[model samples]
Target: MTTKERHKVLVLLGPTAVGKTRLSLELAAAYNAEIISGDSMQVYRGMDIGTAKITPAEMMGIPHHLIDIHDPQDPYSAAEFQEQGSRLIEEISSRGKLPFIVGGTGLYIESLCYGFQFSEAVADEAFRKEQDQFAEEHGALALHARLEAVDPVSAAKLHPNDRRRIIRALEIHHQTNTTLSASHAAQKKESPYDLCLIGLTMDRKILYKRIEDRIDSMLADGLVAEVKGLLENGYSRSLVSMQGLGYKEIAAYLAGELTLEEAVILLKRDTRRFAKRQLSWFRHMKEIEWIDVEGEQNFSENFSKIRAIIAGKFLSGLEYTSEQYN
Candidate 1:
């Protein structure tokens, strides 16, 4: 590949349980690439079951970065993830290996791919606590209405139920005297890398079924026991990791708020909703070349199709040995 044609990163993204991890391993093996996880929840340690983190065997001896790097109690923001993930990408590219960003977190992927600039002002813990308490008492919508008064552009874009982002925007306005929408608009003007984006999607029904099955598998694979262990280890239910979709529902069930069967049903429903939201996020990215997994014959067939696409685009006539990369 010519210097101009060489991409700094190849991103493989899709909703949860769309088989991204397995396909990413094959692509990395094919292209002399290193995998850098784009998952937000997978960054935390002890979040294995809920996050659907790949096991050592599942990784197939490939080196993966940005997984299990943070403690559950430690706060990890998108800005921090972008900084660390970008450094890893740079380091990998400098070594003549391609970096494969693979995960379902659209925001994290966008932040790294575009190099979103964060404010210099530090987060005000006291102010954040106050805001959190207010939101808790008045409800997320009421807090979002308060944000509407300050940054209507952001408030209009974000759903009131999106409390995390709402809180973040409010906090940004309070700390930096600028709206998060303004910062996002400014950041959207430039991207750090010459990006090649690959998005995988499936039929909605199949995707939903896969998500439900995955959640069922998680439960069968000791998901409840995993959360139980965390609780026994002194991790609070209010921690960010515990609030993840599967973890929260399972924890609620363990705490006697719901029966196990009800928790499973809720988990499936929430996961489907999360997948829909993920698709909505990816739909807005115009750079992506989407692959339909629903019609693919099998994993290998799908892998070959993606491999051919990448090879034609980036590796045509390159006499590189795949064995050297794997």
Candidate 2:
């Protein structure tokens, strides 16, 4: 299909705390678009402070989709996000408004953009149980070492603590005699829409500082209280939602596994590592138009550059309804 015949999608992606939220609202208003969240953690209810979820006031009256749609116990995956995002794109486009996806969850955003077809490897429950037993008896690292022997690429991508994904990767290799990385590489990654992928980047030092400051603000805003509430309300510390970046560290502190200072340090370190990983993922995607905001604190100038890039990509003029940002 020609570009004109395809549906248009505008995506703003970056590492956490890289100013995507502020820019998303401005772009949404200027392009007369509705926003769809691309973050994995933001979908859960009552995960506001840690996820840095956009408040209703922060939304500035723009319609945002896929936020607070699930309880903490519910499972959400990239496949589900792809399905919902595709449907939302269609619905939003049908209404003569642009569909804008804004967040930093690389896998979910990439899967939706490129229509990634997940592997069809059937579950091997016995193998899963065996791996669980191994991890329980030996350690997560030992199980991870098994994957490192067979699929080093996947092992590198997964954290040592991410036992579920590590086991799942091993299961795929065990069941299909193929590594997860190979499965992904074999898929024909092609987008179903006229896509505009924008990525924001900045100097590492500055970005890391921003990350630390953001964590400090989250704590000051009662992140510990939020995690405590979740735990008190019977949310398991092992739940996927609780295992997210801010939630996990804070939960550890709440459980007395670590002191507040230790948790804060770990959270900051993990966030910096996560940002590095995010940059790695986006760098591999060839379609992204990267904008460097390094050392530039002015929002309007950065916004103008992005606006021009979008207009050039779509070959159309934006409405420019609003440009002022807080």
Candidate 3:
């Protein structure tokens, strides 16, 4: 399809605990839309509390796709996300309902929106294992430096803390004898969707408070027990799903690696750091319209402001969903 023929998509994305959930549901219901989750972990079954996966009641009758579609042990990559998400976008738009992409996984969402095509060379398990082990022996930064040597262009875009993607870059160079930067630059990819990205932000202090409180609520909602249940069911702690924020900390406590109090403290700290990384990623992206909510603003007022933004961008000044008033 041509640029003028691209499907319109609304992307609600930001750091964790930045309040994408309630607003997304309200917009979807108002616009007669279906949602496609842009979260990496939300695709895993039995990984709810830690991922902060939405409940059915919270969905409010809007159809949601690309979530709870994988077992915790299965591997899911941005390439897979792009393929699946593209299909869902077309499917939803074809039905005359708006297709909304909601979540904080930057690569998955951005690649889907911009039509990123993955290199076709199969992953070399032996090489990946070697790189991962090297990261453990040296450090993520050291591994990232390897990416810098092989593909500085790719390295420039990746965070040192993102060990996995760094490894993938190295692996790409290893297998394809071509740098990741070269592949992506060769494509010179462009936006495949007529998309508007709505990014939420707030005071750093306030966002950190929200992150801490959300972790507290996750624990109270059986985060520890959830991890315990997954382990008892024979899932490995090394699985990517189990390495998530809440799950990893609780797993450390369960393994006698840390006391419960210590684990919780680390959990909160790590999550705050993760939220920082998330914001950094989104800040680097293009075409994002930001909404910065005040600490003192009431929820209803905030929701009204959000609705107005969406109405202007998506609804073209038409009536919005007013029943639940979320």
Itemize residue pairs with steric clashes in candidate 2. Answer: none
Off by over 4 Å in 2: 317-320, 323-326
On TM-score, the candidate that comes out on top is 2
lDDT of 1 at 103: 92
- Cα error of candidate 2 at position 123, Å: 2.8
Candidate 1 has its poorest 10 consecutive residues by lDDT at 317-326
lDDT of 2 by residue, 214-257 (tens): 99999999999999999999999777788788888988898799
The parts of candidate 3 lying over 4 Å away from their true place are: 135-163, 176-189, 295-297, 311-326
In candidate 3, what are the lDDT values of residues 209-253, reduced to their tens digit?
A: 998898889889998899999999999877767777888779989
After the best TM-score superposition of candidate 3, give how far the Cα of residue 110 lies from its true spot, in angstroms. Answer: 0.3
Tens-place lDDT per residue, model 1, 176-249, is 89998788767773566767788999999999988888888898889999999888898887776777888888
Query: Model 1: runs farther than 4 Å from truth?
Result: 1-7, 139-164, 175-178, 316-320, 323-326
Per candidate, the number of residue pairs that clash is 0, 0, 0
**Cα lDDT, all candidates:** 0.82, 0.89, 0.84
TM-score of each: 0.88, 0.94, 0.88
TM-score for candidate 2: 0.94
Predicted structure 3: lDDT: 0.84
